[model samples]
Target: MKLKRARRSRRGRIEIIPMIDVMFFLLATYLLASLSMQRLDALPIALPDGKTAPLPSAAPLTLSIDRQDHIEVGGHAVALADVGNAVRQQLHDDRKVIVAADDKATQGTVTRAMLAAQNAGARALLIVIRHEG
Candidate 1:
């Protein structure tokens, strides 16, 4: 039997064009994702330098308003009418109150909580908001 010469197989080559296309697609996707993460209308806030500031005499009181208009103080739920009394009970020499209201919370609810804090003799009131990126 006559032996036939074996043909050499073609070597596989890496396609740089396809690799470049894939890299560009990934870059564009990441760029768009980063752009969308930015908040356009977010207000810039300058925080106080704590190095020279006096230390707080006491921890700040945290009060929260939920979307359902429920009021919470120190992780305990309290009635809207009783919010002032509850805050008064927790007040010490420092009467600083921080109100954290949900984005979906109604304006009336937030206003009521703030009023309660004021009625409870809070000297300073601060609203807590989520920091935008």
Candidate 2:
């Protein structure tokens, strides 16, 4: 009896289970990371109602924070550490410091700068805001 040759099969189909699992794991990781991030501060702000009194000093020493997060005093960019000294020096007799911060400016910068101005002996701290237009 002649020996029958066994039929040789080609390469078996590749399993996609591992690839699918990897994709799923990566998707889950990204979703979790995205969900874990905390949103920016949106604290409640109440505007003054009724008759508003004028500031003690009409003209105030201006500390501006642009969108780029640069600190400027009296139209001059000043370092964060030097803000207090600069403000004080600029306003020898003045008692008010007005903070004009862009909406895109970092909150920490504005807050810290304000504190610095106060520490530098600003009699009044006025918070000013501008419209996008």
Candidate 3:
């Protein structure tokens, strides 16, 4: 003969708070990672709209033309006349140059900037434009 004994039952549980914390961490990590992966080569300005194209793989020189007609190369202030020289100095082997001009910039200024870069030996002159609707 044996004595009867009481039994205890164990129930598995899922912690919701920890799971939510992990998800938030993952979300923040992905957001930061994506932001880091982007390549920002030029200053922020109002760009015009035009046909779109893929960016070149090689690191290209950025030439920014503000609405006030001020020119900058690789984040450095440069004169309009010195644009060619600046391009020649900063351009890589791919000869890729990105021209970012403001939407309010004069047509002549943009044209001259493009020509200056081209004359400086930029084989791939990519003009940055706004995305079409």
Candidate 4:
């Protein structure tokens, strides 16, 4: 009469909280698909409506304009008398300038591209509307 058996050795585990919730949902879906594939320097306008503001913190300088008026800045092809020396060589220290015309552009080429971004010092001249809602 020989009967004595009892063996249960469970081993094999790797849960890490659902692998850290699927690596935070694939890092939040690769940061919302790389922030919706960002890459819009400027140009391609039709904006006019207005009332939106609030967008500083540096990185403004766009200054586009189309409808045959031509002229550009950050996207190159600038002329209109060198658009104030291409907005003073893309002013740094955050002079802040946007413009982005072309709602049939020609209020004297959007007021001469906002007076050439205030003669290039551009103390701040944002103007790229289109919100009227």
Best by lDDT: 3
**Candidate 1, overall lDDT?**
0.75
lDDT values, one for every candidate: 0.75, 0.75, 0.86, 0.82
lDDT of 4: 0.82
Q: Tell me the tens digit of each residue's lDDT in model 3 across 38-119.
A: 9675666898887777675665788898888888888888888999999899888878888888998888988998999999
lDDT over C-alpha atoms for residue 115 of model 4? 87
Ten contiguous residues with the weakest lDDT in model 4: 52-61
Better of 1 and 3 by lDDT: 3
* lDDT of model 4 at position 27: 100
TM-score-superior candidate, 2 or 3: 3
Off by over 4 Å in 3: 1-16, 29-41, 57-59
Estimate the TM-score for candidate 1: 0.55
The C-alpha TM-scores of every prediction are 0.55, 0.54, 0.71, 0.36
Cα deviation of 116 in candidate 2 (Å)? 0.6
Q: Count clashing residue pairs per candidate.
A: 0, 0, 0, 0
How far off is residue 15 in model 4, in Å? 2.6
Lowest summed lDDT window (length 10), candidate 2: 40-49
